[model samples]
Target: MATTTRERLISLLSDTNEYKSGQKLSEVLGCSRTAVWKHIEELRKEGYIVEAVQKKGYRITTRPNNLIPGEIKHQLDTKKLGHEIHYEESVASTQEIAHQHALKGAPEGSIVIADEQTSGRGRLGRAWHSPKRSGVWMSVILRPNIPPQKAPQLTLLAAVSVVQGIEEVTGVDAQIKWPNDILIDGKKVVGILTELQAEADRVNSVIIGIGINVNTPIEAFPDDIATIATSLKIASGKEVERAYLVRAILEKMEKLYHLYLDHGFAPIKLLWEGSAASLGKRVRVRTITGELYGNAQGITEEGVLLVEDDEGTIHRVYSADIDIPRES
Candidate 1:
């Protein structure tokens, strides 16, 4: 993808601490000085504070916490993921738009990102609370050549990617709550919802919706989730750049995805297990079939949750809401 003028400006500003003169920027970017000045104005409008001096040129004084596409695209190191980004200020759901794009044959790694989601959904139709401009609310499109039955493994793959992204960007330790949730210090920080469009035998596309609580304030959450949900800023005691985290996720996702496609799920499975929060814990899983109480053993080869009950019967859970018991 060709970088935009704004992206080039951001790159130049972020690549160094010294001020970049307008003439130098124009000469390097092959644009007129007026165009460079306009781009700098545009960057200021996007919440970046650029310091301009009489002869010292311009330097980035501060950056916005918002996940503007230009900022994210400029930092992305992936070949395919986030190549085509559809950004929105507010939307009912990124998943809905991503599904529409996927059905219309949107390329793999096309992304639908929003500043806020009015009706964001989590697993089992739970409403995901996404306030305006406080989080990363986006959905990623994937067209892997895998069977429909193996699609659930993609959730694990996404979980690993998100965990890695959070760790790399925030420096806060986080773990995966099996299947799709990411937790920091036992509080949920990220959620992944994977939806597939498929026929009976084959798979067409997979929409992976990833909602991250990056800079959300504690009070922004409802009373019900305030204690359980946390943001990277909350966990790290400092605000994290949303664009940097988003770029990290795409990079990790692309690398892990190629690993899955070439070597298979074994490597991804091991990585997922290493960061899982539910493995070997006593828990209650509420699935569509029924509730199961047992020791969370591990995941099956197909990414199914394996729970060993009291009688030594191992149950393979396809889908469920897990609740790990706490010590009395």
Candidate 2:
């Protein structure tokens, strides 16, 4: 299908925020003035504040500050990551949408992003704070030919890429919390949520959702999470452009993702273990059944955590909420 008339109008408006005459727009876009008016109406319905004047044809009044589909695609410079992005003003979760798309045979590298996720979640179904215009909430769809068992490696690979991108774009020394939370200083700055679709022990697609606190201030977060959660703005001492960070992440993620497909998880795992601060530390982890206190020796080949208790018994943790380790 050809690009929608609304998309054409948006592109025209994005080029210059000032009013472009209706006749001029129609001529530039190769469409009837009625089509231009209809497209403008649709864009207004979609929540973009557009003003129509008697002489001054149309102008973008207010842009929803976000990595929304059209805006993100306009600003992106990449071969992948967000090439097939779907952006939402509000969604229950990007992961949920990406999962549906994955099941419906979306492309291998499709992505879903939103300004606010009403039901954003993390590993083991923990709630993720996703407020509007304050973070990078995205789900990436990938169809890697890797085994189902090796899927968790993708999360580590994603974490490393996020850390690299955040540091490069925002100049913050973001650290990796074991398993998948990216932290700045001692607070959580980003959360990674990875979901898989497989059948008969063969992996089909992996939907990786990342929620990074990019611009939310300390007051914007809930009382319970504010003390522990942080944004790139707070850490970097200024507002970091969400689009730049997203592009940086996609570039790094695509490189590492391709590397993982060509080579194995060994190289990515080494990079993760290096950036990871939780390795070889005494810590407490909570699983579904109970809590386990032990030394976090390292992760196993399949991305399971290897925790050794006081009795020297090694336990492989499939999933858990790990407390940040206090330096001894």
Candidate maximizing TM-score: 1
lDDT of 1 at 322: 89
**Clash count per candidate:** 0, 0
lDDT tens string, model 2, 5-43? 555677778745578999999999898988888888877
lDDT of 1 by residue, 92-171 (tens): 99999999999998999999999999999999899999999889999999999999999989999999999888889878
In the order shown, the candidates' Cα RMSDs to the true structure are: 1.7, 3.9
lDDT of each: 0.90, 0.84
Return the lDDT, model 2, position 302: 76
Please give me the total number of clashing residue pairs in predicted model 2.
0
In candidate 2, what residue range of length 10 has the lowest lDDT sum? 1-10
Q: What does candidate 1 score in Cα RMSD to the true structure?
A: 1.7
lDDT of 2: 0.84
User: What C-alpha lDDT, on a 0 to 100 scale, does residue 151 get in candidate 1?
Assistant: 91
Error of 1 at 257 (Å): 0.5
Error of 1 at 247 (Å): 1.1
Residue 319 miss distance in model 1 (angstroms): 1.2
